[model samples]
Target: MSLDTTTLLAIVAMALVTYVTRIAGLFVADRLVLTGRAKAAFDAIPPAVLVAVIAPTALTTGWVEAIAAAITAVAAFRLPLLGTVAVGVISVVLLRNVL
Candidate 1:
């Protein structure tokens, strides 16, 4: 099937935007002088991002999710990150079904 001119233009526009965003991210990262606190914060970004994303969802979902999050927080201190996530997910599933 042939794509219309408008569709083709839209696809090209999206491709350019995607490429520009990726290039801009690299350019900005190269310019940043991450030292001291900045370096520490940058290193913490992945976990911080996860908490920022997960916290809101956990809070808004039902009691099961909040309970799972609480349990996960405790497990996180003892387990690895992936282990914490797995425990949290399995707990959620069990809580959802059992409660």
Candidate 2:
């Protein structure tokens, strides 16, 4: 698929906005003294962001996607991150086409 000018410009705009906000936040936060609770919350950022990005799409797609996501979640505890993702993607694709 070819990206048109509008799509390219939109992507650039999004990138610029993301960088500006991230940099500004870092600049501001660097000067602050973080407390214990705040530090704990900061440490939770990765998983919280992952869930925020993944949960809605996984839940809304269909039962196949939901089951795949559930399996991925369980697999995540026992398998490597890459393996869990592979299981989820394969299951979702197979289930979607089969049923």
Query: RMSD in angstroms, all models?
Result: 3.0, 5.9
Model 2 lDDT tens row, 1-95 = 89899999999999999999999998998898888999899889998999899999999988888888898898888998889889888888888
What are the lDDT scores of the predictions, listed in order?
0.95, 0.90
State the RMSD for candidate 1: 3.0
What lDDT does model 2 reach? 0.90
Instruction: List the candidates' TM-scores in order.
Output: 0.69, 0.62
- Candidate 2 root-mean-square deviation in Å: 5.9
Where's the lowest-lDDT run of ten residues in candidate 2? 84-93
The TM-score measured for candidate 1 stands at 0.69
